[model samples]
Target: MLLHILARGRIARSPEGELLDRYLKRVTWAVKHTELPDRGGNIPPLPAQARTVLLDERGKQFSSEEFAAMLGRWRDDGVREARFVIGAADGHGDVARGEADVLIAFGAMTWPHLMARAMLAEQLWRATAILSGHPYHRAG
Candidate 1:
């Protein structure tokens, strides 16, 4: 399944952007990244079998094992894509959150939009590696 990350804010040529690129490039699955303005920009269209996941403070925090299992289940269920949305500084509105299949949180602490993008990219790589039985994850 395609793993697409749609994030708000310009990552630019910053260190965070470099980290995001490095991790994303290591993922064996199909991956795509879309960068939007900090405020306004339409997200790309998703495939019919796509599932949207919004990254929000109010979202559920999943353990690495659980996260990997979720990805595996979705793939087995024929999900064509899993699109993860990272909102701007103000975060996502209720309407936007409601449209998502899953609301995920890195932690209760708020993170900068750019760092969130990089973190998400790394997590995606980890999740995919875990799914493939790779030793990189070292799940506890």
Candidate 2:
């Protein structure tokens, strides 16, 4: 399945952007990244067989193995695209959260949008690697 990140705000050329780029390069799966303005922007149409995952503070936290398994299950079930949405600075509204197929959290601590994007990139890489039978030394 395709792994897509639909996040708010431009990462620009900052350190976080560089980190995100580094991890994204390591991911072997089909991947796409979309950046929108902090305020208003029209989201692209979802692909057929799409699953939307919202990154929110109140969401469930999953282990790396669990995340990999979830993606694997979706792929095995013929999901075409797994879109992960990262909200703006103030975070997502209730409507968005309610509409999501899944809600995930990085941790309890608050992180800057740019950093969160980078972290998400790394996690995606790790999850895909684990799913492909690669050894993850620090896996939880």
* Candidate 2 C-alpha lDDT tens digits along 1-140: 88999999999999999999999999999999999999999999998899999999999999988998999999999999999999998999999998999999988999998999999999999999888887753654
Give the range where candidate 1 is weakest over 10 consecutive residues by summed lDDT. 38-47
Q: Write the per-residue lDDT of candidate 1 for residues 23-140, one digit (tens) a residue.
A: 9999999999988888877778778998999999999999988888999999999999999998888889999988899999989998888898899888888989998888998855
Return the TM-score for each candidate structure.
Answer: 0.96, 0.96
The backbone clash count of each candidate, in order, is 0, 0
Clashes of 2: 0
Q: What is the Cα-based TM-score of model 1? A: 0.96
lDDT of the structure predicted as candidate 1: 0.91
Write down the lDDT of every candidate, Cα atoms only. 0.91, 0.92
